[model samples]
Target: MMSPGSRPLIPGSFLKIMFNQAFPGRPGVYWFLQGRKVIYVGKAKNLSRRLKSYPRQAGFDPKTKLLLAAADHLRWQGLDSEIEAILTEARLIKLYQPHFNLILKDDKTPVYLTITKAVYPRILITRQTGTFGPFSSTRTLRQILERLRHIFPYCDQPAGSRPCFYYHLGLCPGACIGVISRETYAKNITDIQLFFQNKKKRLVASLKKEMLNFAKAQKYEPAQAVQKQLEALSYFWQARVMSLELPRLSQDQIQLELNQLFGFRVNRIETYDISNLSGTNPTGAMVVATHGRPDKAQYRLFNIRSLATPNDPAMMAEMISRRLKHSEWAKPDLIIVDGGRTQIKAVKKLIPADIMVVGLAKKPDRLVGVNKPLDLNTAAARLLIQLRDEAHRFGRRQHLRLRSKTLFI
Candidate 1:
């Protein structure tokens, strides 16, 4: 990855250094500050990873650049869980009303969880405030409701002559069909409300008390249901809300996996591709990925000054050689050339022994010019293929633009 110190001096350099020095890699909320004013607030499942991303992101994104330039410092607070981070971020955003947070987020209205003031109060998501929240992340809030609904089985629809869709799905307690009394359904709603209020302890106590009461009365069925709810709730808390979000590999996880695969700590990867049409208007492009995400600002396109032939390996070599001359540019920990063994051999000669080099071959999509065998199904292989494809896309576009210019010339 590009070291923050190696980059040109820019606004928020101090903040970047501070972030690198020691930000906890845990769930938390962070603030970007302009002097004493808090200009933006954001939450992350991993604080250090998210905060460090801003510096690289600012290189290409106008809004990120502007926000970082305007900010002088940063602050963060580590939280125990992702749920806590989400809740704390919403509360802080509300309290500070940060300028960049609102603007960068496009001033979208925050979502709220509201309980309707009716005979059978329905839990809902709305723009207006009512009972529970001005949650910052609508998707996350919805996911939370989905998970909790399976446990509490509250209603989102009005009481009707027939059972609602959720009632059939067991996500509602059959209040709409009058199978469950209003008072009993109300108790479920209360539990949900208490959950949104962050009264986990009180909610657990209430459920425990109800379970004991049912057991004492010999109502084994209701007692067993309550016991199941208690067990599920316990598992939910221990699960850390990760299930609520879609499952995807984090960049850190990807990097670690790649590290294990390569026997080296892989951080920065550069991929090169040559694009040409019968030796005419040949172009070579380099695509960079730092810390497992593309850093578009560092992408370079070469006009292929030294080669007019359609020799891909030679063209690839020329590009790598030219790129290496610029010592000030951040060196990649790994380099991927877009060809089989021959292309890899040409580029590997130019790179130092310490820096790793590999080729992505098209047939069956495997790694070449390296001793390690990599499975195409693995995350590490997928990332390499993704970068290789990006290189091809970038080089092909530049080559087409050059060809178009030649038409007029």
Candidate 2:
């Protein structure tokens, strides 16, 4: 009897071998192995598509190539649903320690924007307990806290403290001083919770109506304040959600594809875009997104140091290489460069083939891969373009911020 650890490697006989062995048709976790070593661990709703990817779509990555060369066996465990698959994958990866997966050190504790789980839950920025976030950055967590406070004034003040600074600054709705009624405060908190639960459009529309109402009552100051807040919320929503030509793929499909390609489901994707502005500052920026939402905490600004003059491609390559060398930053499943064929080719050489890479040509907003340009209308293409655009926006914002700071200094 062949031990599971010593399964025979029949060349060109994978399908025949797996045919006799049960491959779970249902959603669940799967593992590819080279004798005793686990090469990659993944989850899938359709085992056929997930298993097929190993041989059919296994793009060459240094680590994947080695795994493929040695892989003699495939195995899987069935799951109830796709969500379970994700949770299972995350758990197994933590336990088994696969080499291909981009596993970061779990040393740093997560900080959360906790609205205390109390009768009158107070909003606070903390690393303490109770529904803490695995948030990408402090800035991002703070922004979320601010938004929550604006929408639900009840959470803005300390539980027992007097009117806070926010009240004095006219940012809070004066909930701390009883200026806002309990019913109104509760309604606001309910709206905020609903928004966080993915009812953004509804919340935005409601806010718009309220803003108009204040204006109609000749309450110009309050109306302007509400309008400004609405604009900010709109900007945040647009930045995070992709409005595309194609019907958006469900979150599960996107997550599964990402996991298969990169060996893990990418939560925060950080892309680096370099720009020269006529070779003046010659800067590079690292932009971050978490679960398709902008995670500003991971955003980074860099002054181009390697080259004296402007070189967007080379500079971008160097920045990416440096970022990958660090263990703290989560490696993106995809690296998006903002350029045409030439730009893609240059960065491609620098990137290890294992990592999925693509370039976005700004002229037509096209995605350029190894040999062909993908049409952005396709679901896959749209997702890639969104990542590239995010990187570009982040880089541009950093460039402007640095330029303004320099002028002031």
Per TM-score, the best of the predicted structures is 1
Candidate 1 matches the true fold with a TM-score of 0.53
Candidate 2's residue-wise lDDT over 1-409, tens digit each?
Answer: 1122223558777645544544556666777777777766776766656666564433554555556666776667765444335445655555566665533223455454455555455656666343333343466556555434543455366344587656643356666766776666665666665544445567778778888998999999877766755654543343321223223667666655545444556665666677556566667787766664557788877777788566777888778777777778776666767776666777777667767776655423445664554543344455655566566666666776777887899
Residue pairs in collision within model 2:
61-354
**How well does candidate 2 score on lDDT at residue 26?**
61
| lDDT for position 168 in model 1 | 42
The Cα error of candidate 2 at residue 11, in Å, is: 76
Error of 1 at 159 (Å): 2.6
Q: Estimate TM-scores for all models.
A: 0.53, 0.36
Q: Give me the runs in candidate 1 sitting further than 4 Å from their true place.
A: 1-13, 33-37, 69-73, 128-133, 240-242, 245-409
- lDDT against the true structure, per candidate, is 0.77, 0.59
Q: What's the TM for model 2?
A: 0.36
Weakest 10 consecutive residues of candidate 2 by summed lDDT: 238-247
For each candidate, C-alpha RMSD in Å?
19.6, 18.3
lDDT of 1 by residue, 1-409 (tens): 1111122224536555745566678888888778788898888888779978877788789998888788776778876677767767777776787888767866788687788878888888888464555677688788788768868887666677877767644567787877888888889888887776656789999999999999999999988888878776665554455444323578887788789888988889999999888788999999998887778999999989887877989988999999999999998999988878899888888899889888876523467877887553356766786788789889989998999999999
